[model samples]
Target: MALRKIVVLIYPGMHPFEFGVTCEAFGMDRSDDGLPVYDFVVASETEQPVPTLNGFTITTGHRFDEALDADLVIVSAGARGGTPAAVPATLAAAHANGAAVMGLCSGAFPLGEAGLLDGRRCTTHWRDAAALAARFPAAEVDPNALYVLDGRVYTSAGTAAGLDLCLHIMRAEHGAEAANVVARRMVMPAHRAGGQAQYIEAPLPPAGSDGLSELMDELLAELPAGHTVNSMAARVNMSPRTFARRFAEATGTTPHAWLLRQRVLLARRQLEAGHEPIELIARRSGFGTAALLRHHFQRHTGVAPTAYRRSFSAAGPPV
Candidate 1:
């Protein structure tokens, strides 16, 4: 078999990290692994020195034709609005020619702009999720997923999620061994199951809400055994209505939404322990129903509950 060629499409006001990720992954030689190496090229509509977020200039070495027949063609996100503004003809053609096309972060916006993500499961940076969904009604935008791969089209979430996307591709292309190798070299976890929920930041408790931090931590611990926002709010001596606002202000997300994600996290632990059935998992995690658990499980997590338990149980933890 021929060595695969990887091409990245660079645009004006290009994001340094997104494009640099591809360079670090595919452009730089990892020949020490004795794996079939890829030919890496940076292509653009105009082969010129393109400006980037980091203030340094990165010149493209190839034009659109060089991206023809590329095994992988990635259009990286930009720092500015052009991210979803238009899709260059080169990108459109590369996708048409059977190349595996990917959009990283806001890069999915451009892919959506190109009409490529229509009917496909795709995700972008959480900040851009609303815009991505608004811009392309046909795309199933997953705000909480780290990345989405529907068939040959791969779309990733925010900046660092590109690493997960590329590593996932490596696993798909060459298996776990190769992906692990690259991940080890990068000092990052080889795999992170589920989508963006696992990576969401918990909003800190408000300053005046003394004891709320302890309360929230306790809430996390008790969620596995079932705790509702109303119950917790009552325990804190506040009405559910007032508590909801404070919870959102303090934690940066609504109470129910926050609880669901926390439940998923706890369930992941139980799954890894291999001791809990999905029903027990549902009950323990406050989901109330295995069906509801499965819904959020599949949504927040890319894999199903059983599959997650099986894969991660053996692996010993959720990465």
Candidate 2:
């Protein structure tokens, strides 16, 4: 269904940034750029002022009933407790009435409380994934996805991921052009490459000079060159085994894996920039052949190169 009306649920102790994501995505007037301006409302259970997490309050006149006719209803991260009964009741009603419902970060808790997540796939901040699963045993929770959409329910990971989910919805319902326009207005990437896994905290590798940095720069400069670990190790004056160990210690990934990821990123940029043939793009990205590029590209991005180009190319649409 077309998403023209949007209602953002605000509550006491909710994170302001998450709520702002919804507002920024749909509230502003963008008709000057030929984008649809959503009928946006900030709603609560009552007409009272709602306190935010950072010692401030927001006054909203709309009530949860406003969500009943909304095309999209958003729930941002709320307080650290079970959802209020009224919140869930409203969400349940909105969902029953065919509104596309979304919960950002800990907001997924409310959707779970409303039983909207039951037997459906969802996600929240990785830190809260285990707790969300423990609380809602019937929901399949993915800790690594930036966002998950099952049926009419949508859930996202931590703060910035809310924007990703918003842009995704825009892209799906409006078109890539609209999403790209929104992303440009927000000064963010229209589509990110990886999921929340890349954001999870891990022990940083010890800071030191491993020749790997220079080698990587050289490789990036000449990606089409046939460079193997043995060749790389020889250039760095080390045995292949030693090079592999140091590479892992320095980058937290195998050399081959890192190279493949870089190649895929390069391929994505090439695909986004111009109408280069798949064979030419494959050669430039060091995949050697179109079939190999397609294999690895799909494995990493879950989409074919041509499809990605169509969605993100600067030209209006791929021909």
Candidate 3:
């Protein structure tokens, strides 16, 4: 059998985790596993040393010309919007040549810029999810998804999510047994459905005053249906203006953002358990309507409530 070539794109300010994931998954030698061998190489847009966020550097031995010839090409994520990726000519060539392509983390930005994400379902980190949605309204963006496979193009939610997608890819290319062998060697999970949603919620700060703390916890548990900001502020015996400022600084995010994440988390547990219909889930999770639950659920997990339940395929209803 012919050896499958795997080429990974290493850009400046590249994430070590993302690149390491590719190397660990596809770049290792596994001839003894009776699997088709992979010829893996790290190539760069330029021949110079690639800088990383931790101030370390990795030198690339090959360039775009060699990378474009690979059967699989990976674009890795890095600092949020810091490293401006050059849509290297080799990437277009790789796509043109019919190679399976993938974008991980902020790596999706470059792919989007190269028109790779056009007319395809994709995902990125939740922090940049809103921006991606706003930027590419026509393109379906799932910020909360661990990864998304749209035809030949595969995109993962954030840096860690890359591992999930790679293992998923291995399962597809080989099978459960093969994927398990590779995963066991790496001390990672062998199977996480590509459609499994991402759980990225910003934690709220502990309440300063006793009265406010109790109220805050309840509000989080019962989100949209809970007390308003003013009501919360009154519970702590403070003005709404003062309370909002304190809350923002304490939580490191606006109340609205924090609340949305908490609510989404609650809804995910319920959806996975297959406890109720969309309307009940929406009401209990504080979204108030099925459409509202779906909007946030889709934003966070990359799939609708019904789809999420169906993906489980366990004996009983969702759990």
Candidate 4:
């Protein structure tokens, strides 16, 4: 069934940004653009004015029961506290009745409280990922994913990730073209490469490592050239063991992993810009063959090179 009805559950102390994401994605009337206009409702446990975290309040006439027949039920993030008793029961009933339920950021807590997250892969804001896992031991939590979908249940990371999840749902249910239209209207990218791993805060290199930093710049400039640990270590005037250890300390990942990520990033850029064949793109990005590019590209970005090109290439997919 198509997703045409959406209910966003707002509550006291809920963050406004995530709630706004749902409203933007589903509540807007874009019928002139040949898009389906959703029956969107902002509901609460009761038909009351819900206070926000930012000293503002939102009044709504709908109540939690509005979610029971919704095609999608989105639980927006709220202040850190115990899940409201009504939230879990409403979500569980909606899910059991075939509605797709999503938890944005800390909203996953209510889903977890309802046992809906049991045995499902889920995630929330990275700061709260460990707590979500520790509290719901049966839930498989991935702190690095921007979003995860298990059956009819969906969960996303921090604030902006909600947009990504909304776009993904659009693409999955409607098509890439519909998603692109919505993205263009919103002035956001239709798809984003990589996971939340790129956004995590990590310690930077110590101030006195110009040599290693310079080597990294050189490696990026010559990505197509074959590189080895021994070769890179020699360039830095350090043993391979020392280079590997220091690289991990400075970059939070091994040298090989960093190089591979750079190559994949380069491939993504090339794919987005032109109509080059996958084989040529693979060679230019240091992958040597289209098959290898497909392997690593999918592993890194969760989509095949050609599919990515189809969705993002300015000149459209190649013949």
Identify the leading candidate in terms of TM-score: 4
Query: What stretches of model 1 exceed 4 Å from their correct place?
Result: 1-3, 83-87, 194-198, 205-319
Error of 4 at 168 (Å): 5.2
List model 3 lDDT by residue over 1-319, tens digit each: 1228888888777778888989988887788888666888888767788888778999977877766677878888875554444543566678888787888887777777667778989999878888777766767997667889987778887766898898888788788898889877877556666666675545554756445567667786567576567777887787988888877767666667667778887877777676577899888888899998888877766667777666453435434
lDDT of 1: 0.77
Provide TM-scores for the models.
Answer: 0.72, 0.67, 0.67, 0.77
What tens digits encode model 1's per-residue C-alpha lDDT throughout 126-214? Answer: 88888888888998988988888987788888767898888888887888999889988887777875363534644555565645677
List candidate 4 stretches off by more than 4 Å: 1-5, 29-39, 46-48, 68-71, 80-83, 96-98, 125-128, 144-146, 158-211, 312-319
Which stretches in model 2 have alpha-carbon errors above 4 Å? 193-198, 204-319
Model 4 residue 21 CA deviation (Å) reads 3.0
| Candidates' C-alpha lDDT | 0.77, 0.86, 0.75, 0.85
lDDT measured at residue 176 in model 4 versus the true structure, 0 to 100: 94
Measure candidate 3: CA RMSD: 6.9
Clashing pairs in 2: none
| Selected candidate, larger lDDT, 1 vs 2 | 2
Per-residue lDDT of model 2, residues 147-213, tens digit only: 8888899999888889989998889888999999999999877875324342343333345547677
Better of 1 and 4 by TM-score: 4
TM accuracy, model 1:
0.72
